[model samples]
Target: MSQEPGWLRPHGEPWKRVSERLVYDNPWITVTEHQAVAPTGKSAIYGVVSFKNLAMAVLPLFDDGSTVLVGQHRFAHRDYSWEIPEGGGPRDVDPLESAKRELREEAGLEAAQWLPVMKVQLSNAITDEIAIGYIATGLSPVPTDPDETEELALVRVPFREALEAALAGQLPDVMTVAMLLRAYHMARERALPDALSRAMLG
Candidate 1:
């Protein structure tokens, strides 16, 4: 019998928690401070931010190669930001439903097709915030009811133009930038429908 390789051996050691305590919390997020043993045997204190909901974003692509973008003043950055429709969905709720609602609220559009494209960690170093991206097509106009706290501007532009802006740092929202690049990649690689890809690339 051949001996098992060292690489094949189980390496299931996780960060051993020594102690943990709640530092702060709100309806949206919770901060926890933990004393833990690292995999390499070092002991340290870590602060983690836990999100109460999952972030969801939608890229609403039209048949004419245009997409919808929403502009708003972001309180955290203290500046105006242009981004694809996005919102928070409760962990217990379906992300697709949240995406749909965001689209309707932000862009006044409804999509007949939805393709989940990516899942990402927004900030691994300090926050446990997960975001999901979707490509939405077969769109139609719908009534919009934006949240009372939001004062938004909507822009419809060619997909290529939006992508160029995102690449050039005009669109700083992480989800929008990532999803635009992913959509461009899909178009170049023919990962989407033939007509849609052709329209987007052009």
Candidate 2:
């Protein structure tokens, strides 16, 4: 008999699940408690938060090298926040559509171009929340139709300044921070258009 290739084998021993219970359920999230056996043969209890939708964000870039940010009071954090246009995309929907809707609803902007920047996990240790980020250009005005629950303020700032704010911890939203940093990296590495990159760098 031929031996199995190392690459064909499992990367690690799988956890043996003993039991799982639904701890909580909401429109957007579900929490579950699980009892499992570890790879080391030790029993463990774990809690996992699962999201019903994919988190999506967009960095709207203008021809002038400026970007739009949305400011609002976050109830969960009980603080004011400035972030890129972000919202939840239903699992069955395309994330780009969600990003476009959020940008229009939050900032009243529409884009002729959309470049997906990154996909990431928000909190792997505690939550199974995934986020997709995009850079939107070729912009135009649109009518804002924000969620009634949102009381938002729009701010237009130079891309570099926004990035600086994000780096300085002014923008605490994970999606915003990561996307801003990614944009900066892309500009510096010439991953973006020369004109656009030059405008943003300035």
Candidate 3:
């Protein structure tokens, strides 16, 4: 790696964890309270929300610049959100498998090709949750088997429309916004298959 003039550097001492105790535990998440020292040497009380599974998402793309989106009422935000297929998989499981399952269950679609698009730390300040996203092509319809907890609404729309919605903040989920922007970048840079890129750009 070259040390370019415009590059940034990281130089900092790590935070010191003095003590931690579990305050709440659930199958999906655990909350732990910690007595910690910040990197600046300040004492602080921190509560961390840890996830038990890896987050996964997929953008199911068709050859003609069309995509499948799923809508559901989010409990945390208490609002309806339109997003790509997303779910959680066991940390030990492959993320691609989870992406495929989410596409099937949320959008009733399956893909013959899958490419990793992005990896994100959802909230660096609060949670230890990471999300992985993928772009899936060569799509086919299937029966949806959504999780019992989900009451999903499905829609198919042009890729450009979805991206525009994300850009306008209509789709505010961090994972969805990242995936859409990444997909746009890939299409412009020809990172995807040629025909797919052309179709997506159109």
Candidate 4:
């Protein structure tokens, strides 16, 4: 292959092989060391992942147009965090399934309808993690089945209020914020044809 002018030539056969190997990796993430040979040959290692899986956050709008939010203790930051119902187990289950499961598990709510609102990529730096957002309308309260390790509370707030809270970091979950933002715009633009989503836009 002809060398690209702006691109760097690998230091040696070892660096070239490593770079190629890093790009075509499998499930697990990998890192490769390389040095630029053009303007400057600064040595660096690039971390790469084999495209992350998708997660889901279900924002259920009640009959009154209020959206459901969940408050749970986030062990990562040792604080109670507020977010939409969201979780992911494995790729075996569809992202929508994860959304519905999380809604029931965390918020004790079930929706009669669900709509795909947004698809957000959590991190593009190295991993390809995507968060699929859903708008669940026609909600009804139900029994929640939280695990022993989970302490979750359900809050139904106005959609605008929820958006404000999410923007203010009161929701604290990065994935939740990204999902909401994307869904909010979709709802606003009338991109979602569902009647329930009109409440989300409203």
Q: Tens-digit lDDT track for model 4 on 119-156?
A: 77776765666778788877888899887888788777
Worst 10 residues of 3 by lDDT: 2-11
CA lDDT of each candidate? 0.94, 0.93, 0.90, 0.72
In model 3, how many backbone clashes occur? 0
Ranking, lDDT, top scorer first: 1, 2, 3, 4
lDDT of 3 by residue, 1-202 (tens): 9676754655688888999999999899999999999989999999999999999989888999888888999998889999889999999999888888888888898899999978889897989999999999989989999999999998889899999999899999888888888999999999998998888888
TM-score of 3: 0.95
For model 4, which pairs clash?
A: none
Worst 10 residues of 4 by lDDT: 12-21
The sequence of per-residue lDDT tens digits that candidate 1 reaches over residues 1-202 is: 9998889876867788899999999999999999999888899899999999999999999998899999999999899999999999999999999989999998999999999999999988889999999999999999988999999999999999999999899999999999999999999999999899999999
Count of backbone clashes, every candidate in sequence: 0, 0, 0, 0
Give the Cα-based TM-score of candidate 1 against the true structure. Answer: 0.91
Question: Model 4: C-alpha RMSD to truth?
Answer: 7.7
Which segments of candidate 2 are over 4 A away from where they belong?
Answer: 1-12
Query: How accurate locally is residue 10 in candidate 3, as Cα lDDT from 0 to 100?
Result: 57
